[model samples]
Target: MSRIGKKPVDVPSGVTATVNGQDVNVKGPKGELAFRVHDEVVVEFKDGKVSVQPRTESKGARSKWGMSRTMVSNLVEGVTKGFEKKLEISGVGYRAAVQGKELVLALGYSHDVKYPIPEGIEIKCAKPTEILISGIDKQRVGQVAAEIREFRGPEPYKGKGVKYANEFIFRKEGKKK
Candidate 1:
């Protein structure tokens, strides 16, 4: 049995959740979000909570059980508390700025990299080296952060580039003289 799948997702006060067939929708003070669960799992709402269960005792159903439950929980959390990701730019002359609707990044390149911000997502530059990304959808927030980090991943030698705020870069030793 899946431990995560067995636990029901509690719908906190001021947040509303609904299950329509394979779709789960959640609305809260912050915003609203929805998710479509796999056919191998069944979703239900009751007692101010949402639950997910496998439709059959099969490998596919078992694999999707916990995933479906987490998706429902994420929908509720996203609509209520939302999600956030922080990126740190580290390199000589490297920095970031929010220019209107685009994120302008200078990662030691000749030209500034401009990234157009997407709808429902917010990007802010607290400092020249700090990028804060927030959104109601967890997946979208993470995706945008990943895309920015991919532009200049941290190098093992100098450990310079865009990296997650909490991430650690395993530095490598320089060649011996």
Candidate 2:
């Protein structure tokens, strides 16, 4: 049996969950998220909690069972509390700004890179070097942040590029004299 799958997901007040066939939909104050449960997994919501059960005790069923349950749980949490990603800009002239529905980034490139903001996501720039990304969908928020970071990946030598606020890059030592 999967330990994670055995744990029941607590349903918070004001959040609603519905299961339709294999599809699971969760709605909360922030937004709504939907997921499809695996064929070998069965889910139930009762008494302010959700539970997942595998149809069989096989290895494949056990493995997928936990993942399906966790995905459902994450969907619930994401809709309730939303998701956030923070990015920091490095380099002398590299910076970022929000222009209407686009994110304008100057990452030491000859021309500025413009990224269109997707719907249901919000971008905030406290400073030119700091960026905040917020959205109800955890996957999309992370994807957008990763794309922005890929625009100018951190260099090993100077570490001048965009990176997650808490990310760390290892610096290489200089050659001996």
Top lDDT hit: 1
Candidates in order: C-alpha RMSD to true structure: 0.7, 1.2
**Model 1 Cα lDDT, one tens digit per residue, 101-154:** 999999988899999999999999999999999999999999999999999999
**Could you give candidate 2's per-residue lDDT for residues 1-177 as a string of tens digits?**
788988988879999998887888899999888998989888887897888999888898899998988898888889889889999999999999999999999998899999999999999999999999999888899999999999999988888999999999999876889
Q: Could you tell me every candidate's TM-score relative to the true structure?
A: 0.98, 0.95
Candidate 1 lDDT score relative to the true structure: 0.94
Q: Which has the greatest TM-score?
A: 1
Show the lowest summed lDDT stretch of 10 residues, model 1. Answer: 71-80
Evaluated at residue 135, the lDDT of candidate 1 is: 93
Q: Distance (Å) between predicted and true CA of 99, model 2?
A: 0.5
